[model samples]
Target: MTATATIDEVVCLRPATSTDFDLAGVINSLLKPVYELPGAELVHHLSGIGDVGRMIQDALDEAPDDLYATGVPSSGTDHAVWPVGGTTVEAGAGARLAVGITLPVDGSQDIFLWDQDASSDDLLGSVTISEAEQGQGSLSKLAHSDEEHSYYYVNYHVD
Candidate 1:
């Protein structure tokens, strides 16, 4: 009989820091004109520009690490069982995915985490789950890059 592995959620304990700041600064500058428009001040005040700006600046201070995951049911296979392309999750947030993927009882799956960016994608880390690990469980992995480190928690179950 075949068993199915279900992905419950992926939690980001910490996000990676960005080394590229010039590009982000340039992008923010391009949006300055929008803030200079007439009535923009009123809108800004109504929307709490101080708070919004702080949040935007905070995000720009780090890598726009929009996270996503991919699960390969088996090694040497070009097929992916979950997230064909990817399902993006917010930085330092958890994505609850009740995606179930079926595999042979003796089969195993490798799950990878990635940070999606405009320039290029960064691989965060990966974890392998075997059918023998059936039942609810969580796995943790740390992804390191130059001076940045990212921590992730993956929760899943096989039955």
Candidate 2:
């Protein structure tokens, strides 16, 4: 019955429920890193950038390819950073945070949270959590943490 007034910053919710949405499977094994495909077939390799929410920070600190994520489009194996575009379901608040993202073609997801008040672009920290298949690492750290902000997801059919 109510909506945020401006696109200056917005949250967009995905389909609430999907016949295709397998919460159990996703929890078990849906979002797994993509390794089967040859690296050539890899559209891109996602890298989690830390504390890079500011556009000015991007200029001061070089991105992986030494290019800016805000400028230029994703091309070839550029390995550029892109914000994933979608809605993030926040716990407790029952309020969804609208998110924008550009990620790899596979299960590996680079997590980014935009902070409106702190930075101009409105982002805070960068944490990279790969497909759950990574087993244990930073991804596991966030997964196992008491709480987490957002995640990049993929949908696969078990049937």
Candidate 3:
């Protein structure tokens, strides 16, 4: 008797981890989402020299093709100081930066990654400034223009 061809079933195998893997991510924000670190800051700055018109033109000329990232990210303190340190950019005519920071759900502590250089920036209004402007006068305009003004009454918690 001719042996009938036996129909067979086969199974493809996969690595244990691949099949039974554990992965986590915020798929859908249930209630205002959760961030390991929450808070967004909108920082605006004017870097360069010349009159308001010139400064604006210069800023625009030197503006990054992408306005969103014109300057590199430095410590809030350092970013503040850069304007005054150089002979190229006028001390007062340096960068005028502005950014908005959204406070974290877990208090200010869970906001920014408060690194070594970045202490809790005592905010002036909702805006956090560079270190140079700290301890100045009423606002950035007063601080950068006046020599007597120093220190800010605000801080950005980045821890």
List lDDT for all candidates, in order.
0.51, 0.24, 0.20
Q: Which regions of candidate 3 fall more than 4 Å away from where they truly are?
A: 1-53, 56-60, 69-98, 103-159
TM-score of each model, in listed order: 0.53, 0.22, 0.16
Specify the highest-TM-score model's number: 1
RMSD of each: 12.5, 19.2, 27.5
Provide backbone clash counts, one per model. Answer: 0, 11, 43
State the lDDT at 125 in candidate 3: 17
Tens-digit per-residue lDDT, 17-103, candidate 3: 111111211111221121111222111211112234234224223211101111223334343322233211211212233333322
Q: How many backbone clashes does candidate 1 have?
A: 0
After superposing candidate 2 on the true structure, give the runs of residues whose Cα lies further than 4 Å from its correct spot. 1-92, 97-108, 117-119, 131-159
lDDT of 1 by residue, 32-118 (tens): 454334332233252454454335446656544566665642321123344445456555422223444444445776776677667
Superpose all Cα atoms of candidate 3 onto the true structure and report the RMSD in Å to 1 decimal. Answer: 27.5
* Residues 36-134 of candidate 2: C-alpha lDDT, one tens digit per residue: 232211212321223222221233231211111221222211332333232223211111223233233244443333322212222222334344433
C-alpha displacement of 122 in model 1, angstroms?
A: 0.2
